[model samples]
Target: MIQYELQQVTQQYNGKTVLNIKKLEIESGKIYGLLGANGAGKTTLFNILSFLEAPASGQVVFAGQSVFFGRTELHKLRRRVVMVDQYPIMFTTTVFKNIEFGLKIRGMTKERRQAVIDEALDMVDLAAYRGASAAELSGGETQRLALARALALSPEVMLCDEPTANVDVENQAVIRALLTRVNLETRCTILFTSHDRLQAAGLADETVVLEKGELVDTSYENIFSCSLESKGKGQKICLLQQKIPFSLPGFVPEAEGRDYRVYLNPDKIKLVQGGQQVQQRRGVLFGTINLMMAEGEKVRLIVNAGVMVTVLLPVDEYAQLRLAIGDAVTLKLKPDAVEWL
Candidate 1:
């Protein structure tokens, strides 16, 4: 079931357009990862979904009901959809009180309120800290408290905006596990935004990439624009980059333009030590590591050959190789791994 749908949604700020998505459909009971860079209008999109900010011109439909801006009925809808901000705010009170306040406002009975609060605390692994002061908790604990507060409400949809952005690695793992458990057990539809690609791939059932306030294909991660030089046998497309001519088989474009885009999944690229032979019959390119960074349990590496290529591998594999910045490495690209975009 589609829980939320946006049609011709366009949001503006000071007469300047920010988000201009034509259409988007969010499915029910699935964890979705919203990915983008800073200032990519991710937060704005979240606000629109949470009904905190209305679009400049568009329609938002939640659970088959059309939601209009400034409607008193919106408050009722908002109650079913809770949002956890990047930086959670805590009232100057005990953690148990903070989680109980929302339940009290909803007129939950005293017995039920205590039961739900206890369950929420256990869900976040904060049962021992329930009586502690909310303001004195660590960054990770604060985030867990915020999540506990949301969970106490028993919202149907949870919109988390970078829930683990400011937490340490240990806390990040804890939050990720908590989210996964919640989605599986409670069947709550979760939509979360993250700047880390690996985190999205790990936590979300489906991932969407946002660029310049518009939804872009996730394949754009490895897409490269190049002019087609010639066609080889079996309708192979030869790109004009390296003299060795990298050709993709069974892909022929009918268009007349020579310029085209090709996509390669980061996982498809295999990295080998320099001077090592590729085990498979794959196209090999030698390059220097331009940049490398840890993404959760994976390491994302940017290699500079004739063209820049992105590669992802397990952190354990990277550590075993003992690779570092400016290291020379050989990348193996299988013929079937390349796809035309």
Candidate 2:
């Protein structure tokens, strides 16, 4: 079943168009990751999905029913869905009271609320901190507390805006596991926004990319703005951020000197062998490996050359390279790898 369907949704702020999604369908009981950069309308779409703000011009269908922005009984609908912000605001009170507040508003009895609170806290591994001060919890603990509070309501749909953005690495793993547990146990529909593409790919059932308020057909990273400069001889130079230049084959007449978005697919990028001498090639980028993560049978790496670029290699090949975090490596990008977004 489709949990939510958005048709021709467009949101604006101060007379400027911020979000313009034509059609989006969110199915029931699946986790979705909304991937985008800052100001890419991720939060704006979250607001609309949470029904906190209606679109300027569009239709939002919830659970097979058309939602009339102001006419619908939003209070009842809001109870079935919850939005957790990146940095959750906490009440200057005990953790128990913080979770209890929402339950109280819903007219849950004290005994019932306590039971729900205990279950929520246990789910988030915060049962021991029930009496702890909400303001004094660490970043990860606070985020988990917010999740616990949201869980207390048993919302069918949960919208998390940068759920692990502010947390430490340990907490990031904990939150990710907790979300997976919640989805499996309760089968609640989950939608979260993250700037980290790898993190989204690891967690979400489906990943959606939004660029400049429009959906892009990509989930991998390395989206950059580059300008085409004439290099003569039927070739051109694609300057990344007007700095790092990568050679492009036979240029189009219409694209000359024009700034456009290009997506360098991670899998399409080739990594030079460890023992090979670094040579200055047309599509070669020399960079140090800054980050590495295991993604199933593949190893994902972030190379820091002039700009950070993501590269994915097979686990066997990554093991053969014996590369470390600070190891310098060369990257080769084929002309076909540079896709116009």
Candidate 3:
């Protein structure tokens, strides 16, 4: 079922358009990662979805019901949809009380409230901190408390805006695990925004990119904007910062002088030692590793050949290579790896 639908949604500030989405539909019981750079209208879109701000023009449909701005129906819709901000604010009380506050407002019985609060706390691994003061909780604990509060409501839809943005690495992993578990066990529709490409890829069932207040593409992480440098052998090769030149297969630009966007999947690129030679197809570029980090089962490497290129290798392959930061590596780009956007 389609949980939420936006039609011609547009928001403006002082006569200047901020968000202009033609049509977007959020499905039920799925995790969606809203990926974008800063000021990409991500928060504006979330505000409209959460009903915190009315759009300049557009209509939102929830569960097959059309939602109107400034109407009582919106209040009813909000009951099923909850939002957790980037920096969540906690009540000046105990963790149990903070989670119980919403339950009490819904007229839950004393016994039922305690049960639900306990379940939520356990879900976030905060059962031991139930009686602790909310003000004394760390950044991760506070965010987890906010998540527990939202979970206790048993909302049908949850909107998370950078839930782990301000937390440490360990906390980020904890929150990610909690989100995955919640979506799996409760089947709640989760829509979250993150600027981290690897995080979005790991968590979201599907990813959408927003650029300059407009929906760019679903494969946002793989897309690159570049200008064509030259053409040869029926293929157009583009140079990224006059260093890395890769051919664009079956892509003929209308104007050679203009810039174009292309998509290259990170998984398709193979990373090898600097002196290795592999013949047959595609191209190879040597570069020093700028950064390397473990992302789930894969190791994400940022290579600075000319422009920074992202490559992901399985843990087994990465372990065999024994790669590290500042080490030189060669990237093998397959011909079929590059796609026109």
Question: Best lDDT goes to which candidate?
Answer: 2
Candidate 3: tens digits of C-alpha lDDT, residues 1-341:
99889999999999999899988999999999998878889999998888888899988888898878766867777778899989999989999999999899899999999999999999999999999999999999899999999999999989999988999999999999999999999999999999887788789897778877888754466566777755556555676544456654444465677767666678888888875334323467667999787777988888876767788889999999999898888877776777765
TM-score for model 2? 0.84
Report the lDDT tens digits of candidate 1 across residue range 1-341. Answer: 89999999999999988898888999999999998867778999999999898999988999888898667877888889999989998999999999998899889999999999999999899999989999899999999999999999989999999999999999999999999999999999999999876678778988877877998765336565666553435344445343334544345576644666666778888899775334322366677898887777889898876677789889999999999888888887775667775
lDDT of 2 by residue, 1-341 (tens): 99999899999999998999988999989999999989899999999888898899989999999888774678778988999999999899999999999999999998999999999999999999999999989999999999999989999999999999999999999999999999999999999999988789889998888988988877648988888787677666778777887664323335676788778888878887442335435777788889999988899999987888999999999998898998878888887776776
Q: Give the better candidate number (1 or 2) by lDDT.
A: 2
Give the C-alpha lDDT of model 2.
0.88
lDDT of each: 0.83, 0.88, 0.84
Q: Cα lDDT of model 1 overall?
A: 0.83
Check candidate 1 and list the clashing pairs.
none
At residue 223, candidate 2 shows an lDDT of 86
Task: Please tell me which model should have the higher TM-score, number 2 or number 3.
Answer: 2
For all candidates, the clash counts are 0, 0, 0
| TM-score (C-alpha) between model 1 and the true structure | 0.72
Sort by lDDT, best first: what order?
2, 3, 1
> Each candidate's TM vs. the true structure?
0.72, 0.84, 0.75
